[model samples]
Target: MTLGTHGEAGLERGRVDLQRYGHALMGTYGEPMRVLARGEGSWVWDADGNRYLDLLGGIAVNALGHAHPAWVAAIAHQAATLAQASNFFATEPQIRLAERLLELAHAPHGSRVFLCNSGTEANEAAFKMARKTGKRTVIALEGGFHGRSMGALSMTHKDAIRAPFAPLLDTVVFVPRDDEAALRAAATEHAADLAAIIVEPIQGESGVRPLAQGFLAAARELTRRYDALLIMDEVQTGVARTGAWFAHQLYGIQPDVMTLAKGLGGGFPVGAVLAFGERVGSLLAKGDHGTTFGGNALAAAAANATLDVIEAEHLLDHAKAVGEHLRAGLEALDGVVEVRGAGLMLGVGLAAPVSAQVAQAAVAAGFIVNPPSPDTIRLVPALTLTTAEADLFIAWMAEHGTRITTEGTTA
Candidate 1:
């Protein structure tokens, strides 16, 4: 519904729903934000009938954007045909999606893929696989966010959360993000006991900072030196978010193991871990690990359909072109410290700690944006976003950026 017919009533109803949501739901995320009702393309309509240009793209999950025909059709068709089955049974879409990912990743012929429900679960599976290697220690970068589950949380290097879950397995080492010296020292210090070294091609949560090519190469070298697995956590940067099927494509360096999610199933919940080459691929035998609803038919079909749309529509090239436009425009703005990232995944750095205010003002002005930190605004808009739409947000930033930043805001 647009704003014309149901403006005030819809908003009131939405507020009521939010109140109900507060009492009925757990308070993990605190109060409700927006009672988003529906979406299409790069726009979403709230229950209040207000419209928003969705620049956040549901935190990089909606690769194809809202209500894409192909995405809807795939899920509907799969649900009508065969929605799910036991792990004991295999489905066509599940197998096809797995094969397609391996092919896109350019993994070896016999490489393996493990499917799960979300990025965290994918990381959990990767963590279990790392443990199976018999090495007691694993190294991960600081500011890296894997997931919230116990094991994934251990790998996640957040002091605020990690402190609460202290004295974890103590098997994971945290290296400063993008610190070449720290990485080398950690790798050297724990080289013998290292099971795997997990790094994000682009740090998503802490900030949208892409790891340097040389740093990625160094991590690969360190892993190889200790005979440890190099695992790339491309959960946020994979599935064409970074102008490539995988962000690792930009580096031209391959990891022995890779975790992917976010856009894997477009809007559906699906995650995967692909183990490259023969030896690592064969690590998880029959009963060694399992998933009940990881690669169910519906989610797999959605993923397969998302892949087809990405290729057929040539969104990758579109992302590159439009991303340049967005970045250049944002960088030209006052107070914009820098803009970093490839394709639709971009982080806008500000001179002061005003990202939260910027994001709030953007949303209030009818745009959806995110503050990853006090100083960085993240934009992971839908790949389907048009250059015109990007220009619209750019104009908004140019006009309101300074004023919006000075005001402490929330959306």
Candidate 2:
């Protein structure tokens, strides 16, 4: 955690950037934390040249870690060859990436892909697709996070985010997460007119709670019975974040529609909707939905490179093993309450509501973490994280566990 003095000059420069950033940028993200200078693998350096282990992975966006060679090469090559093309004419990377994504999703040949720039846009497209089914009702899990766009925001469960925008889209019902009974009851009540049921295979924002396998299966059954589409919002749990290509695969359930973003492009902004059905492609006709930069060459190339490196390096197996190590080590910490979630997307519970303090303490101790709520600390570190790094974080927790729970809040 010791910051060397040699980079003091660079740190001052970072301060200048922070000052300019504050004045020029919008306050939607609140105050700046540290001006990050550079990163590689699982580590990042700040403006003051302080080093820290990035445990959050840019909120689960940096799948291959920063400055990965394959990602860098792919971006550079695509930028040089073809940055973007008119949507009227498809680029090779775009076509290739779409085909690759379908294969990864285990989707059949007739399945299709709708690319976009972010998770919110992907959900918006999905929402429109659902409406095209001629059904008026939709179901979403409470506390589930779809996106910030109007339609996606309407399906989200948090009141704090929804209060400012009271009039969200209507007829979107809510069911308790992981509760099969409530989900079934809602389906029974609205099955006749339901368009779709949007569910996160594992609810990431709600403290890493995964829906039960039975619940996911039941959703499929109900949707099939009522002729409704099943939408798996895998924006956070996709791209091997859960040790599988997608979390729904673990449950062995096939959704009609799947939305992806966070890790899809290896830190680049990209989102996609994977629709798989005999007639899926025909639902959204031309001009029914589109984005100017959705399937650009550069982003698709980044995504292709990310997928390429993941398979080449066997990061999926690595994520599984390291996640098990982290789970067991975190549970061994004295004041730790529980460890939830799959693979690298973990949530560490504390004996007290001091997750904020523990996160701050972690920052001072040279680690980056997220305190999404009061009692739970979310860890979505890069899949590239190694067991040694996991062990280092475990040692850090073991050394500072009790203090983190007790003294963390005060600071």
lDDT per residue (tens digit) for residues 1-411 in model 2: 322343345467777888999999999898777888899999998877778899999999999998999899999999999988869888988999999989988898689999999999999999999999998889999979998889999989998999899898888999988789999999999978999999998887878888888888999999999999999999999999999999988889989999999999999999999999657767899889999999899999999999999999999998999999999999988788899889999999888888877787777777888987788889999999999888878887777755668565433
Q: Over all chains combined, what TM-score does candidate 2 have?
A: 0.96
TM-score of each model, in listed order = 0.96, 0.96
> Ten consecutive residues with minimal summed lDDT in candidate 2?
1-10
- Give the Cα lDDT of each candidate: 0.88, 0.88
RMSD of each: 2.3, 2.0
